[model samples]
Target chain A: MTTDFRSNVAQALKQDAVQTHFRTVVDRLRAHRQAALAGDAAFEQLRNRCAAIRADAIRRLPQLLEQFESKAQRNGIQVHWAETTLQANRIVLDIMQRHRATFLVKGKSMVSEEMGVNAFLQSHGIDCLETDLGEFIVQLAGEKPAHIIVPAIHKNRREIAHLMHGHFSELPYSEDIETLAQSARHFMRDKFHAASVGLTGVNFMVAETGTLCLVENEGNGRMCSTVPPVHIAVTGIEKVIARLDDLPPLLNLLTRSATGQPITAYVNMINSPRRPDDKDGPDEVHLILLDNGRSRIAGDPELLKTLHCIRCGACINHCPVYRQIGGHAYGTVIPGPIGAILEPQKQGLDAATGELPQASTLCGACAEVCPVRIPIPAIINRLRWESVRKNQQSQNSRPVVPGAGSRRRPLEAAIWKIWAWCCSHPGIYNRLTKLATRLRNRLPAGMGAWTVARKAPKPARSTLHESLRTMDIDHE
Target chain B: MNDARKAILDRLRLSQYPDSTPVKCDDQNDPVDPVLWPDERIDCFINRMRAVRTEVHDASHDSWLDILHGVCQARSLNNLLVSPHTRRGAMIYAAARRFPALKNYSQSIEDWKSELFTAVDAAVTSAYGGIAETGTVILWPDAREPRTLSLVPPIHIVLLEKNRIYNNLAEAMRIQNWAMIGMPSNVILLSGPSKSADIEQTMTYGVHGPKELIVILM
Candidate 1:
């Protein structure tokens, strides 16, 4: 996916300023947090417990994932393994075709976006609908999520009212949120029961009990998984945790981090579909565990910590950079601090995405706010080195610069040649520097691009070596 | 066991690095803690519960019935569907009579679970069962009371009476232990209405579950 980073950042700055839209969401999340505190002290206790459970599960991720697959298989859930996004998309399309589904009702799944599932499904003539309210708004707008937790944060009431008025002919243009929401509510209620297949993103895949944990503020996730005859959950392999005991701590961190609440409005743990003599749930459940560069990341000691992320977006919310640019500018599915590291690795360190790593100010706010403690800044820097290395290798492998002995570009060779001359002749360098310092004030416009955002300090009158020699006169 | 699982587990066990050690709870006959006397513990529990996103009510007032009636009238749920648990509460029956078509069920959770999907217009279950952080419900998965009652219904109205709300999930889990001889087959955590954001990444409520979720906090 191509990310217009500059435009996304500009848009984020614009929409976030509007008090009615983004502020209302921020207020509601705060209200949810306050309610959690008011009603139950145990919310925090369970949150802590869920966190510990997740931490332990991550510690034994590979084993737990294997266990989950086996158990899920026993429960009649067909498990498919995809090493990359291409594979994941293909698998989902095949499943949709097998089911002969025309309209696919989907739940909020970052993994699906990561794999470009919608486009692939659409290309195959399978129409998919995003059921989450925030996701629905962004989908209609034809844009990537601005915020992970609240994807439509950039949209205000007027924009939503306009969208609803345009989409629903029966509804009048109303600025009221409740009235607008009711319109959307009526729009999707039937789509849920009508769709043949349902798609969801797994929050946590428990290995011990072979259960899938899905936490959502709305009941749409439950409907997507249950109402449809066939349910498909696309989750990264890293989602698997070892035991049920490890759920509480992760849930705690996820809730507080995502919404500042003790827990989400609902946490649905499904072991299997409606069994024999059962009245509810999907008839068949299929879980697709996606690798898509995750295993490669998991093998690396430095990058593995990212897998511990629960997609809470706390880091994004707290990040000054993310708040300024929002998620779309990151140009990757997982945005903010996590995106800076994961995107380049998941895609490549090629030119299209090379500017992303450079986008960050190396601010540790993302790391600080991260519940599982992913070192986003460090990983970003490492990716920069990898990108540089790839650039050097390509340059080295190129044919000798046509007429010269050098195999590098003229610009590269010229820069290095100048550096060699300066190092080999320090006295000449000192004289040239002095001359430049004298002419610095007289330099023409566009002399430097680096100094536009900042100013360069004036050079010293004399070289350090010369000053040292002059000071030696006192010693004599 | 598949070769993958065995291989992964073997590598983990052989590793020298320390991993999480599981702790076993010692409640065989009575897993739940009976004594609720510690004021500090209660206070801590209440404070933490408030820290999450639930509203707490002071139960000191004798007019709990008035509170119920007022909340019902406000949410426009005078026509209610209630579980047997609410019948035991003081003046709950009087409040039920106010709604002309109020449907009351004395059936077990299993029967109610099935009936809720097709028959019940708006279903209400007890919230006195669970704890704070997760907002989970402790439903014993037996022949009479199935796990689907809380999830399948379109509009599920959970009744969390004053005394039933525990300080945290630990106390709730402790209660779950005592309710049955051992751990029940299922435990559910409900935080909000059923929703989805699958189509073009737009969130539409009432996707698979109830469209409108109203909590009558009395």
Candidate 2:
């Protein structure tokens, strides 16, 4: 299917409510992050340390995965590997079937969202519930998460009140945020108690200790992982860190960057299933390590930076494009600068995802706020080249990215070729420019998408070279 | 599944550089500098906790039970969950008549799941330690005190020793030798009561977990 990026953006831009919501939410988030980081003198050093830690982890990803698997298995935690989302979904289904568990309660897991786990389970006659408040709101509304961290950020309090009232007829309609939250809590309490299995996403996987770390503000994560008999944790393969010591700095950076909190309410570390002597905890802990195009991403040294993202959503909050159009406009799982670079690589360049890279102003705000310091703008430029480059074949060498050069147009290529040729020869360039300058008024005002919201550029009355020569300035 | 593992490992291994040096990660430098004085740490911890809307009460070992009784009476809690096997639980049990009806989490969650989810009014558990920098309480939930005692109840009262407050998470982990000792089934660093800003970024407390977290620092 072709991407409706332009139309989606058009639709999002026209929604005044969404625009106001994005502005208010992102501004508050930006201020929160700034305030959280303001007093710390070591903030820059902490970010550098975090970036290095992630870089080191990605560099040693294969070995770390092996170590984590062995250590986790020794700890009596079952480890599953999935090369694709389909494989991952099947593994989850198989586990649920093995336990005869029809009810699943989940914490906020972007990877599970990547797998479309809820839809997959529901289709198979299983009851899947989102327990995180934001996710629950989005799920109740039959919508995808609008933002990575704040899933229901697109909905205002009034909209949420209506949605909650419509869904839970017993609850009174009130726009009070706390009342709405409490209603959700009351509704989910039974679900949590009844859920046979729980699933969550890993914030970081410590290979040294075989520990799965999850950070969240809601107690739903703890409840889901602890309350259920079976706990399944899913994460991308790249989230593995070499040692446990790497966690504190990364956690510090993540909380500060994500929501401007010194720390979240809960930073849960799961080392194993409940011990035989333990009072309460999951009997079985299963961790799914999903590749899902991340291995290919690691093959390219420059593009490998994409995997270092901690999914803090700080970059998204800081992105100018995302600020105006909001997340839905991007039409990807994770949106803004990070998604622009990631979705294309994961979905291949020829697919609808290829259009995502163009949804940026390359303002460098994302890179600036990025805790791990992924050079998002540089990566965006590289992907743009990868999408439209004419060099599809080069003897024995194959492109690292799938569908590379699929977006190249012969007309655009020919135009660039002519422009290059003219620039090399000054005589033809000077004559052509002079002729164009004389006939500047006859030039069309329209220039495709650029002219849609902007005036088309007109040639100067005289070429720069001619003007310089007339003023007795050096032509060079 | 095994084939998938092998294939993914192979692809990742192929991407590795032949001469990549092991990355040196320096963890010695503390991100948040450790406060030197015990008094400073305690003060900082209290400030941080109170900032997050957590109720912190300074109490002596002898007077903590009285404070607990007052807290229960103030909230009009009908029932409080406690782990009777623990020392503090035993103490509370000894003076059980001063507080509300006391319940022990001796049975498996499967046995008392309904009461724990709906009936429990408050819970009192012992914290492994407190992190001063983030105002976090560390709980290594195990046999004595299950994970849900601190989670399921609407009001969670944690008793933290004054000496156990560390400057930050890294220091706490190191001093406690968490990596060497091996992690419990779950280790929670709780900074505040459960909260969410998901609804239009408006801060809402008690979305899924305990709405009120009261730390009895002794």
Candidate 3:
């Protein structure tokens, strides 16, 4: 994926419509969030609470998982555990195979994207359909989500109208949003009723009460969870919190920051499969707690904050880099500032992902607007350092020692060493500078892509030491 | 019990460390506006809900049926899906003597979901009440008034009591103690009709759920 990063970014930037779409929508979202926060004095207080909840949950994650599992079991939900994507996919397939599910309806779940659930199910001869309107569009288009919240934000309505027209040839083609959405809704109603199994992603799992909460605008979430007899909710372990009471502020911050709404249209809390006396809802509910490298991250103090992310995509919207290139350029399930640092470890830390850690501009906009206040810039820098360390280790045949090779890092170290030596001794520095000044014209025009938009600096005629020596000793 | 669960939990438990003091978990509910009277809170809720494109109407228990009939008439909707077990649905159902022109369908979604999802024009379900801060109606769905009534139908009419409106979700849930007792399998917080701004960020309502949300504040 990193091999094509440069090309993907260049191609996305070339699309004038994607640029205008992101510019208008991001500007609107930024203003909407600002206006919403300006009216509320408790914004900071609520953010602090949300951060505290995330921190405390991470600290006591094991206990919370145990509590959640016991309570969920008591509530009649079967809990499954998976250590990796393959295991998670296998579990999902086993359930589907047991039920002989021919078709399934799914709510938007990034974890499913991480596990490639749709592709895996299709390989096993089961058709898994995405029910979220944005997800539905992207699925039909055979593309990944362009953005976290708005999956098809990169594609204009005309493209979607064309896509829909292609899918249902009998339906009249109209670029009108009403027609597109109406067609989708009418088409989805049949899938919702016919699918015997339902799959969904969870927003928050409350350990105290044993409930999985889902927030969305369209009622697809409700339909997928309620319409099927067998419902499966797969989520990362980091999503669990201590109690249900911790949700209000997080909910406030999440909705306001994500789409700049007071609340999303629907927040569904499912405590269990339908009780025996219940007239609606699934007969059996399966909750899959997926580890998939998250538990390893939980141990590291610096990387643990990645788990704090609520998947709100606030940082992505505010990111200038993301606005320019869009999410597809990131080439991962998640994108934007979060993806820059996260994709490496989530996908696999190889030469392919080494460039991803360098994707960010180290701007602090992501941290400022982050609902959970995850320090994204610091994480990116750490990932960059880790990538450098990995590169160094791969080059050497000798066994690596911790913190032993910083002074021997080759090119970067040699440059820094020369720099430190020059700063200390003025004699050689002045002589070297004079030589550099004489040979300034022979210097290269610019280095790589940096020269594209701006001119390179030319060497100065004299060093600071020479200038100071030539000046009067006492101007006063 | 899976070995993966034990293995992951073991690793996590060993690696767990909290540098900053942990945030204590407590029930400190936010009061959006405590000084306001109950009636004022209801007014606040209506304004916020209306801001989000939800239609609100003030009504008494006895007058709600007429208001509902007018809503049905306005949309030219003849068939309504209602649950006989729910209070609001039963109250409106009991008012069949006065409004025989409106048809009310009372059947479990689990049994007749396919027919209801297609044939029903609107669904009127009872609310567990509303949150004034966010302008959301809370529905603790049981056997009657299942989630489908609010989710599938094009029109979702909610019956929220004026006195039942609370400050926010925290206050409402704490007061109700839903996690401890009287916990329903599902709790739904519907702020407005189903909407999507996914296509070029243009807001469009009623994509999958009800397109119109009408609230009768009794």
**Highest lDDT, which number?**
2
* Candidate 3 lDDT by residue in tens digits, A173-270: 99899878888999998888888899999999999999999999988988889989999999999999988878887888899998889999999999
Candidate 3, residue A104: the lDDT equals 85
Q: Can you write out model 2's per-residue Cα lDDT over A37-81, one digit (the tens) per residue?
A: 887788888888898899999998999999999999999999999
Candidate 2 residues lying further than 4 Å off, grouped into runs, are A1-3, A392-396, A469-472, B20-22, B28-36
The C-alpha local distance difference test score for the whole of candidate 2 amounts to 0.91
- Give the candidate order by descending DockQ: 2, 3, 1
Candidates 1 and 2 compared by lDDT, better number: 2
Kindly provide the TM-score of model 3 when superposed on the true structure, using C-alpha atoms: 0.93
lDDT of candidate 2 at residue B209, scale 0 to 100: 91
Tens-digit per-residue lDDT, A40-135, candidate 1:
545444444444455556566666777788878887788887766787788788878888889888888999888888888888888889888878
DockQ of each: 0.20, 0.81, 0.69
Best by TM-score: 2
- Model 3, residue A316: C-alpha shift (Å): 0.3
The parts of candidate 1 lying over 4 Å away from their true place are A1-59, A390-448, A460-476, B1-119, B126-128, B133-155, B159-166, B170-187, B192-218
